[model samples]
Target chain A: MKLTRRKRNMALITMTPLVDVMMILLVFFMVTSTYLDLDMMPMVQSESEGVAAPADPAPTLLIRITASGEARLRGQPLTAQSLASALASQPRARVLILPSGGANVQALVSAIETATKAGAENLRVVRLEAAE
Target chain B: MKLKRRTQPPPQETIVSLIDVIFFLLVFFMLVGRMDATAPFEVSPPVSAAGESLPKGGTTIAVAENGALALDGEAIERPALLAHIADLLSKKPGLFVRINAHGEARLTNLLPLVTALERAGVGDVVLVITPNPA
Candidate 1:
């Protein structure tokens, strides 16, 4: 009975092995995971009727936003009010907003608001398509 | 009476089993973690109704979120971007421009630069995207 008690007390409960295994597994996952930095933007399909129309002769104003949140109109710096006034002077025809690859959504929205306030009849947001 | 203590052998715990588990997990993650390298550039280019994939190795332009312009990772000032393209055009005719924009980048930052590119005679501009890994 004393030997049995001694044997029971001697049972090992080591944790080093378990810890080693876990560490290796963690490192493995960290290296193997794909690191994608870009997020997908929401896209809306243009209506068929809109697509059928021929290109209008009226000058199309282009608005671009950069990743750092700077906004430019035709390579010129213009405030919201100035942009609005510029759009208002146009024929109220077509306004194209072409944002950079990582442009902010808020900037785009603000630009759209300015264009609409300037009485732009047709406003289209255009993105560059990746060539296959 | 004095008692004599008997020496016992150390507990037998092998690290082989633990190492095996670790190796298995390592291999599993290596296989599962394949991700697209180009997805982080965040430029969602406009897709045309008749859009087709072009071959790689085109001239690349990086439009950072801050509206900074980089041609093949080399930063260029906004005023100089057009001139740089024109110079490149003389050296390598028909060079396509690939725009890799960030998602948080504002559209206001891209429009004028693109217009400038067009004016500078960059006829072919391509956007880069990573296909969804299902």
Candidate 2:
């Protein structure tokens, strides 16, 4: 009796289909994700612009509220009672309340109420355009 | 002596399984994706330079911290907001509607209010903001 010898064949695999599927998924996610623009908020300047400036200056009654809940009027800090007292001196017909950023809403409301109580007829909240 | 040749089994392919894994991943992301979900209706808006100084002579609407709606500080219901705006518009054809929404307020709540203002025929709508303190 004689011994027999044999040779075995090798196998090959292709990955073209897998790559195609992954590419499709990457495209889908790229389209769906919401891109937040951090710079969307415009910067407000302390001074008013000449082009959009109103002729009469509108007798604005500026109010500033800090993040810590402090309230001020035209740079002068005031309590709720004092706010009403200061408003009483101005003509209430055209009063603008400009609250600084991070101001407390409760304080802002209180200021609005005080202004209204002081007989402010036309109260406009001022939103200045972003400085160029 | 005698010699013999042997045939090998075909290689196993996994293209279909790979595609399945990719599909599952896609579905997972889709399910967990964040849709237009914004913060709750209680934000104090930061001052922006993009917002124009409100033009003269418009009706003012205020959104309070507790989500109460007010027109000129008078409490008004959501249903009545449109009517109030409409009535105001009848008196002044070019009535501007200024929205003073709190910073904590949700954008979702504010959008519907803006749509109502548009329906009420407000030509100019201004969003009021408070500037950051020094």
Candidate 3:
């Protein structure tokens, strides 16, 4: 007499653990990530890549940012329009921003923006050093 | 005499759809979010329309309104922060330094730090800003 053989069923793989891990990671990223729309302005760059200084230095237009976040050009209040017209005459003027120590970062940034929009190519921020 | 009635069993819910949804959400978050070290204090960067799109990968230095400084999310003093940055510069000469300063932070605090970073031989340094104030 022949013995009867028993058939074995296939083992099913569970996805519960993988789902749990993914859920945890999703929550982690959602909680920890900041969703700010950030941009950047270059503060320092290698001088090697910069344009060489001309034999005749371009006229310098100094923009000052006061403690109250006002941009002043040559002691006169400077606006975007005024700066544009002023830059029209000497297009290659080196725009220097001398910000007051008490002024906020917004003031400095605003001054930079004004200079940039007025077609100033040689823009520089004149940083003040504290007295020892 | 009474007649007996049979009840139907509940159907098993499939988890394949759930796994697919979760996989898509996970991938979306990973792609959209930039994983950077956040400062212990709140830092709202200055706003400027002239700012260019921020490049990825850099060492961030956050400055609070009260002149408090943090390097890579850890609260640090000015001298110590500079020293740590100098060390990082030695290891990675092309290290990019980003200053994520609060909008109301004093220029005294920000400008000096930038000067120090430049003096430390950091070739690429950027001031983090935003196009929209909101």
Query: What is the overall TM-score of model 2 with all chains considered together?
Result: 0.34
lDDT of 2: 0.57
Listed in order, each prediction's TM-score against the native is: 0.38, 0.34, 0.88
Q: After the best TM-score superposition of candidate 3, give how far the Cα of residue B73 lies from its true spot, in angstroms.
A: 0.6
lDDT of each: 0.59, 0.57, 0.89
List the TM-score for candidate 1's chain B.
0.57
How displaced is residue A92 in candidate 3, in Å?
2.0
- Per-residue lDDT tens digits for candidate 3, residues B15-79, read 99998998899999999998888899999898889999999998999999999999999999998
In candidate 2 chain A, where is summed lDDT lowest over 10 consecutive residues?
A37-46
True contacts kept of each: 0.17, 0.05, 0.92
What shift in Å separates residue B108 of candidate 3 from its native position after superposition?
A: 0.8
Which model is ahead, 1 or 3, in terms of TM-score?
3
Which whole-number lDDT from 0 to 100 does residue A74 have in model 1?
A: 72
**Which segments of model 3 are wrong by more than 4 Å?**
A1-8, A47-52, B1-13
For B1-134, candidate 1 gives per-residue lDDT tens digits of: 99999999999988768767777777777665543334333445332222234444656667766667676656777767677889998897776676666545655565556556665666666444433333
lDDT of 3 by residue, A3-91 (tens): 98888888988899989999999999889887988899999987634577789999998898888889899789988888888889888
Name the runs in model 2 displaced over 4 angstroms: A1-132, B1-45
lDDT, candidate 1, A11-120, per-residue tens: 67676867676776678578657554322222222122235656557677887766654667878764657667776677554778776656564555445555655566
Q: Highest lDDT: give the candidate number.
A: 3
